[model samples]
Target: MEARLETEVCVIGGGPAGAALALRLARLGHAVCVVERHAFPRSHVGESLTPGVWPLLDALGVVDEVRRGGFLPALESLVCWEEPTGRRVRGRAGEPGLLVDRGRFDALLLGAAASAGVRVLQPAVAQRPERTADGWELPVLHEGRRLVVSARFLADASGRTACLGGRKQMVSARTLALYGYWRGDTPHGPETRVEAGPDGWYWGAHLPDGTFNAMAFVDPELLRERGIGRRTLESFYRELLGRSSLLEAWTAPRLVGSVLACDATCYRDTVPIERDRIKVGEASFSIDPLSSSGVQKALQTALSGAVAVHTLLARPEHAEAALRFYTEDQRSSAEQHAAWAAGYYRDARSYQERPFWKRRALAPAAVAPLEVRPPLSEDGLSHRRWRLASDAALVDTPCIVGDVIELRRAVSHPRLGRPVAYLEGVELAPLVDWLGQVPGEGLTMPQLADSWARRMPFRRSVAIMGWLYRQGLLTEVTADGPR
Candidate 1:
C-alpha cells in the first residue's frame, strides 16, 4: 500500500533551514512534516558559521545540542586584496566566528526537528508542489512510487534547488558559485580566509575536525567567456589563488577531502508571498558569499517563516501580508548584498583591467546609493570600513595597494606593530583608548591603520573594535533603527 500522511505544514529539504522551521512548528503543536533526500552525516559544504547564529539556535532551543556537536571557535578572519600596483595587501583581521562540521551540524538540527514531533521522510525525492482543493499537495517519489501528501502550507527550504521558486518562474540568476570541501593542513586560528584576484574570489576556513571548507565564486559571464569546465575547476582556482599568495601555504596535495562542486545564485521572486506557499533559505533569496551570510540568512528565514506559517494556520487572512513582508525583506537584503559582492568581484585585479569589468563595473546596477549606517560599536571599525569600501568605494574604482594598506592600518588601530614581548602583559584597555583618539568616519580601514601606525608602529593591529562587534559589543542599526 502507498503511504499517506497529513500535516499542517510541509517543509521540503530538511537542511538547517528546513529543520529549524520544522522544529519550530512542531514545538508549537502543529502537525508538521519534513521531507529530505539525504540521510544524516552527509557531506555538505559551508562548514563555518557567523557568530550571531548561536542566538538563533538558542532561540530555537537547539543551542546546547548544537554546541555539543564539536563546534570550533573562529578567532578572526584574513582578507587579501590584490591591488593595481602588482602587490597585495592583507587587510582587516577581526574577532572569531565558528567552524562547524556541516555533516554533524545538519544531522543535529534535523534530529532536533524530528525529536520535536516533526515527521521526517528521508531518502525521498520531492517531485513538485501542486495546489489541492483544500490546501496543497506535495508529490514525492518514495520507494519507487509517487506519494502525495496533503499540507495546509508548503515550504520550500530546498537550498539552491529552488523547488517552488524554480517551478513558479520566480527565481532569477543574479549570481553563481563553485564550492567544495578540503582537508589538508588546516588553517590555524580558526579564521575565515578570503583571497581576491582578477578571476574571482576564494574563501576557506578550518572545519571542526581540522579539515578545511573552501570554495571559489566567479561571475557566470566571466566563466562562460573563459569556458570553465568541471575538469578545470582546480586549475582555475589554483591560478586565481596563486596570484594572492595566501593560498600557497595550504594547497599541498595531501589534503584529506577531495574537491567537490556546487553552484549558488541570487534568485528573487516575481510574485509576492501569498497564502498556502512560502520559500525560505536559498530558495527564497540568495546572494554571493562575500558577506558570509548564508547560515544567518537561513536562520532568519526559519524564524520568520515559523511566524508566517502560524499566522497562516490561525488567521489565514494575514498570511499574504506576512509572507509579503518576509519576501520583501529577503529581496531587499539580497539585492543590497549582491550589488556589493558583484562590485567587489569587479575590483579584483583580474577583472578590473579587463573590458568585461569595464562594462559591468560601470553599469547602473553595479553602483547604487546605499543607505549608510554607522557600525554599532567603535570596535566594528574594520568591518564597517571593508563594507563601505566594497559597497561604496570599490563600486567607483578598482582597489589599489594604497587602499588595502590603509584598510590594514584601520584594522590594527593603536596596536600597529607592537610585539607582545614589548607590551609585557599590560592591560589592552589603554591601547584601545589610545586608538580611539583617531576618528574613524570618512576613512577606510587602511587609512585608520596608517594613522594608528604613525603613533608607534611595531605591532600588528587586528582592530579590536571590529573584533568587538564580532564579540557582540556593537549593535547594527539600519536607517530606520535597530533591526
Candidate 2:
C-alpha cells in the first residue's frame, strides 16, 4: 500500500542523531517521522561509547533501558600512542560509562523513538528532497510502494552520505579506519587501548561477548603509495596486528568478517541548517575518532538541533537568528575538536618527527590550535597597542565577560566567573578593555602592563595582547581616534 503524509519534522537516517531528534520533537508536540535505510541489528562500527552519553540518554528517558541491555561497564583507558604507556580515568568517581555493541546500541535508541510516538519507516530510501509549499518534500520507497513524505522542516541525520548531496564536504584530516572483528585470548583488560604507529594509529578493544575488535587508522594516499589496498584487507589487517606490541600477545587471532573502512578524516561537510531543512549528526559534521567523541558529539547536535528547529517553527520571526546560532555552535565545535586533536599529536613528542604526526602537530594555533597562544617577547608587543572592536560574525550573548558585567559577545564558553570574549571562535575579550588611558595607537606591552598591573602580572598582560593581535580583535587607532 502507498502512503502520503506531512509532518512537522521529517528526520532522515535513523541513527542516534535522527532517533534522538525524533523523540525530542515528538515530545515537544511536533509531528515527526524518521526514515532509515538499514534495519536494526546490522553490522556497525564505532562501538566505543562515551560516559557523557549517559546524561543525554537520561534526558531522553532511555538510560535505564540501555543500562539493562547488558553492555559492559567502562571507566578507564590506556594509551601507547607515543612512548611510555599512559592510563587515564574517564571521570573521577561515580562517572562510570558503558562499552556498547554498535548495532545493538543504535537499535535500542531507534526502538525508544518508535515507542515515543515517532513515525518510523525502516529499510526505506529517501530521495529527491525539494522545497514545497509547506516546507520540504521528500520521496521515499517503503514496503515496495512509492510514497511522498512532506514536512514543514527537514532533519538530515544520514551520516557522511549527507542525504543532501552537492554541498561542500571539506576535509580537515585525510584519514580512514580499517577494522574487523577478532576473537582470541584477550591481550589486556576491558578498557580501550590505543597505540600510535609509524604510519597512523591502532585501536583495540575487548567486546562484552568474549570477542575483540581491532582497527587501523592510516591515510589512503599512504596505502596506495605502498600498494597496501591492492591486497585483501585480511592480509593487511593481519600484518598490522602482528606488528603491534600490545595485541601481538593474542593467541591464534582470527578475522570474523571482511575488513570494513570508515572515514576517520576530521571534516565539516555542510552547514547545520539552511532554509527549511536542518542537518544533524554526521550529516552536519564528523569528528576524527581519536577523541572517541563520535557518539557524544552526534547526540549533542541532535539535542541542540531539535531545540533550534522548534524555535524556528513556533517563532517564525526568529528563524534566521535561530539558524545562525545553531550554525555557529556546530562550526565552533568542529574547529575546536580539530585543534585539540592536533595538540595531542604535538604532545606525543616522540612521534612529532614522524610524517604521520608532523603534518598535524606543527600547524600554528591560528591555523589549528583550540585557543591560539602566541609567544610573548619585549620586541613583539613593545610597540603594539589594542582597542576592542566589534565582530560582525558573532551574536553578542550577554554574560559576565570580566570582573564587570554586561559584555556583549557572540562566542563564549567562559572558564569560571572570569570574563572571556571570542570572535569567530577565537577568544579575545578578557585581554583588552576600553581603558582610554593608553596612547591612541594602543597600549604597548609596557603601557598595558602599567595600566592593568594591579589586575594582573606584567608578563601575563603582555602575553594576552600577543594573542589579541593574532585574532585581529584589537584596533590600532591613533590618538586622533582613527587609524
Candidate 3:
C-alpha cells in the first residue's frame, strides 16, 4: 500500500542545511517534513567549521550539545601559501574552531531536527517533485513502500544535485578535488595544514576519529590530459600528495579508502527563491573550498532561509520583500567569497604563473572594490563636528525584523554593502533621521554620541558612531568648512 503524508514545508536532503531549516521551522510552530536520501551517520565532506559557526550554533540552541560531541578543537592552522616556508596562524585565546567527524556531526544535527518535532523520513529517495497549485508533491521510495509527500512550501537542500532544477551561473574557474583518508603510525598535529603547489593546492587535517584526510584541488583538464582513470586514480592522488610539504608529513602513511573526486567549482543559482519554493546551502550556491567555510555558509543560509520561508508562508503581503532579501543575500555572499578566494589565490607566489592559479587569480567583474576609510585618532574624533554625508540617504530595504522579513527604512551609502537596517540589534533608521535633523553646522562627536545614548547603551552608541565613521557615512565639519 502507498503511504501519503502532508506538511506545510517539505525539505529534501537532511544535511546541515536541511536539518537546520527543518528544526527552525518546526520551532516556529510550522509543520515540517524532511526527506533524507541517506540514513543518519552517513559520511560527508566539509568537516571544518570556522569560529563564526559558534554563534549560529548558539542561536540554534545546539552549542552545548556540539561542545559535548567529542570533536577536536581547531587551535591553529599551518599554511604554506605564499612561500615554501610555512606559517602558523592561531585562533583567539579562548575561542577555537572545530574539526569534526562529519558523519557523526551531521547525524547529531538530524537528530536535533527530529527532536524538535519535525517529521523525518530517512533512507528515502525522493524523485523529481511535481509542482502543485499550492506547493509541491514529491514521490518518495522508502522501505519497500512508495510514499507521497505533499507540502505547501518546498525547500531544496540537496547540495550540488540541486533537486529543484535551476541554471547555475559560474562564479569561478572550474575545479575538481581529489581526496582520500589515510592512517599513519605517528600522530599528525591537530592543526589544519594548507599548502600551495606548482599545479594545485593541498589541504590536510586530523579528524577526531584517528584518521587524516588529505585533499588536492586541481583543474579537471589536468586530470584528463594526464589520462587519469579509475585504475590510476589512487596512484595519481598519492603522487600529488608526495609533492606536498605539509600533507606528506605523516610517517608511513597508508591509504585507508579509495580515492574520491568531486567538483569544487564555485557557482550560484540564478533564482534562489520564489513565492513558494526556496533553495538553501549548496543548492543555492557553492563557494570555493579554499575558505573551508562551506559548512558554516550552509548553516548561515539555512538560518536566514528559515526566516525567508516563514515570511512567505505567514506574511504573504511581504512576499516580494522576502524574495528580494534572500536573493540579494545569496548573491552577495557568493560574490564576496569568490572575490576573497581569487585574492587568496593571487597571493600564492609559488605557482601564480601556472594556468590553474592564473585563471582563478582575477576577481569577478561584479565584485565591487571595498571602500576603506582612514583611521582617526581619539583627538581627531573629538575635535571635529560631524554630520551625515550628503551621499547618505534613507532607502526602503528588506530587513530581518525579529522572526519575519519586513520593509524598513535603511541607511544607504556608496561605501556600505547593501543597506544598514540595524546595528548591534538596534534600529538605524531613527538614528539616521535624528542625525539629519541636526543643524547645518552639525554636532560634535560627544554631542552626537550622547544623543544616541538616550536610546541605547552609551558604549553601543559610540560603537555605532565609530562604524558610521569607518563606513564614510559621517562627514567631519572642519575650519575649512565640511570639506
Candidate 4:
C-alpha cells in the first residue's frame, strides 16, 4: 500500500531558499511540508550573503539563530580586475555582506522552518510531480519507503536537482569548483578576501571560531586535462593555493571529508514561476559566481516568491498574475547579474595572466550601467567627474559635478532604521574648479562635501551620454573592443 501525506504546500530541497519559503508558508498558518534529499549540517558552496539577507531572516524571525551559527560579518570585497590603469580596482561588497558556512547556515534555517510548524522530512527526495486536477501529486522517496504527497502547490527548491523538470528543464553550461575549509595558525582580518589565483579564483573569510574558510575554483578544462580524481581534487587545490603567498600563509595541511564540487555556474535555463509550481534559489536562476550574488539572489527569489505564493493561496483566482510578476522579477535579476559577470571576466586587465581566468573572467555583470562612476584621485586634492548617459537634462554637454552623488547607497535595511551606504565614485568636479581650486589630497569625504556643498555651472561642455544599459550590455565587451 502507498503511504499518503497531505499538505497545503510541498517544498522540495531544504537549502536556504527552500527553508525560507517553507518557513514563511507555515508562519501564514499553512500546512507546509518540506522534503530534503540530504540531512541537516551537510556542506555546500557559495558561502557569502549580501546585506539583503538580513531582511529575509528578520521577516522569518530567525536572524539571531542564523547569526549564532558561525556567520561572519563581511565589510567589503577586495576584487582585482583588469583596468586601463593596469592595476586592480578593489570594489566593496555593497555594504557589509555576510560570510557563512553553508552547513551550519542551511541547518539553522531548516530547523527554524520546522519550528514554525512546517513539517520536514529529511533524506526525502521527490522523484516527480504528477499533475492533478485539484492540485499536484508528488512521488517522494524517504529512506526505503515510497509515499505520495498531495499539495495545493509545489515548490522546487532542490538547488540544482530541478525536481520538477517535467515543466521546464534548465540548460546550464558545465562548470567546476573545488573548495575546502581549514584551521591554520596564520592571522587574518574580518574582510572576506578574493583574487585571481593559480587555479582560477580564491575566496577566504575568517570564521568566528578562529578557523578560516577558503576555496579555489579550478578550470574545467584544466581539471579534465590533469585527470584529477576525487581525492586528488583536494590535493590539487592545495598545490594551487601554495603558489599564492597571501592565501598560502593561512592554510596549513587540512582534511576535506567531502570536497564540495558543482558542475553548473550559470543558471540560464530554468523554469519560470507559474500557477501550478515554482522554482526558487538555484533552481530558478543560477548565474556566474563572479557576481557573488548567490545567496542574495536566492533570498530575494524566496521572499518575492512568498508574496506570490501567499497571494495565490489566499486568492486562487489571481494566481496567474502572481506567477507573471514572479517570472518577470526573476528574469530581470538574472539578466542584470549576467551582464556584470560578462564585463568583469571578459576584460583582459582583470585576469589575462592566467589562461583559466581568461575563460572564466570574461563574463560581465548581467546588468548594464551598474551604478559605475569614475574613481577619486588618491591625493583627494583633485576629484574627477563624468557625464552619465542616463541623466536626461544633462544628455548633451552635461556640466561636470564636483563630487559623486549618493555614493553611499544602502542596499538593505529594516523599515524603522537608516540603511548603511558605501562610497562608490567621485562626483561634481567642474564646479569645484570654477569656484576655486580646492586643496587636493589629505581631504576626507566630509571635507570634500563641505567645500563644494553647492552645485555650480560649467562652460567646458562636459556631456553626459544618454546610454541605457538595461541588462546584458556586457555581452558587447570583447578583446578587440575599446577598453
Q: What's every prediction's RMSD, in angstroms? A: 14.5, 7.5, 1.8, 11.9
Best by lDDT: 3
Give the clashing pairs for model 2. 81-196, 385-442, 385-443, 395-410, 396-409, 401-419
Q: After superposition, how far is residue 154 of candidate 3 from its true place, in Å?
A: 0.8
Cα error, residue 356 of model 2, in Å, equals 1.5
User: Each model's TM-score?
Assistant: 0.67, 0.77, 0.96, 0.69
Candidate 2 lDDT by residue in tens digits, 1-483: 557877889999999899999988888788999999998877778877777887899878998888788888776667776575665546557757667887888999999998989999998999879887878888998988898998999889999888876365554558878888877655556677787877778887777766678888877777777677535666776776666654643676667767887777776755668768888888888877888889989888898887778777776565665666677668767877777787788777766787777776643342322344354553554565555544413335433222112325443222111124553333443334333334556555566556656666666655665555455445556566744
TM-score of 1: 0.67
Ranked by TM-score, the better of candidates 1 and 2 is: 2
Error of 2 at 84 (Å): 4.4
Q: Residues 374-428, candidate 3, lDDT per residue (tens digit)?
A: 6556556665788988899999999998899999999998867689899899889
Q: Across residues 1-483, which tens digit of lDDT does each residue of candidate 1 receive?
A: 767788889889998889998998887678998989987889877776776786798878987887677787776666665454323223235533567788898889899988888999887899878888888888887767878889988888888776875433322243455654554553444456777655556777766765666666666776677887877866766565456544443645243444455666555555425677778777777655666778878888787777767766765555444555565566656655656665665666545776434433432242234345455345755543322121111111111121010011112222121111112222334444443443434344555456556445424433543443343323333444333
- The parts of candidate 3 lying over 4 Å away from their true place are 364-376
Q: Give the alpha-carbon lDDT of every model.
A: 0.62, 0.72, 0.90, 0.62
Prediction 3 global C-alpha lDDT: 0.90
